[model samples]
Target: MKVTVELSSLNKDDDKIFGNIYFEENEYAFPEKGWNDFVIIILNWWAKSILKLLKNISIEEELDFMDGPASVKVQYLKNNSFSLYFILNKEVVYSSEVDVELFTKAFLKELNSLIRNIKENRWESEEIYSLMENYKMLQKCFIP
Candidate 1:
């Protein structure tokens, strides 16, 4: 399974970024806030558990939109070589790679934790709380 994360248009677009995380065919595209929003949500929701997964990951870039690189990327080269390419404003910025197994483990762990909290209505923020409420309401719909 390939896990590709793409980030684009961060600096110039009102300092906002957009991104998509794909697990082979499965995709969890973040909202307009991009990966930063996802990170913020994870940190705000459960930092103590997922922060350790960052140990093996490293992203080095200018992060300056005006006088520096326009994008950033991260990928996993070892093992399965799950790659993440970050393009800023349709321009290539940087690339980061990491192990898919480790990243997926952490991702699923956090996702499970998040869903558990949502189901339990233990969100500390209104954003997530509302999200969970909507999710609960969505549960009533029968999907074929």
Candidate 2:
């Protein structure tokens, strides 16, 4: 399937950093960051995870985004195949074309591991705790 992830203006310009994933159709686009702030940092971590995931899946494609934070739309083939687009920095905006059940299972597993690691390490500094609380609050806007 052709999956494309477009970056917004908030992200930067990188001619050589395009098409870093395994997608059929390819294009250039911009991204934007919505309500939640510190999008860049959040996406930085998210991008790393995506890169690692894609490697594990043996998908070859390109990924491009501005140096800052931005929003994105992840699209794919198969007549509206599963895809995900969301603001990583802002409460994790997500759009998906994958199977909901499977995705949920995998996502929850990974998230649980991440949360457990954070808790075990006691990495929640005052500032980080503040951000985590804010993120939790932002999640309420969608989860409920």
Best by TM-score: 1
lDDT of 2 by residue, 1-144 (tens): 222222221222221112122122234222421222333344334444443333344232223344434444443434423365544455434444564334333433333443354466454444335435443433333352
Q: Candidate 2, 125: how far from true, in Å?
A: 4.0
RMSD to the true structure for each prediction, in A, is 14.1, 14.1
List TM-score per model, in order. Answer: 0.34, 0.30
Q: Give lDDT for model 1.
A: 0.37
lDDT for predicted candidate 2 compared with the true structure: 0.37
Q: Tell me the lDDT of model 2 at 128.
A: 38
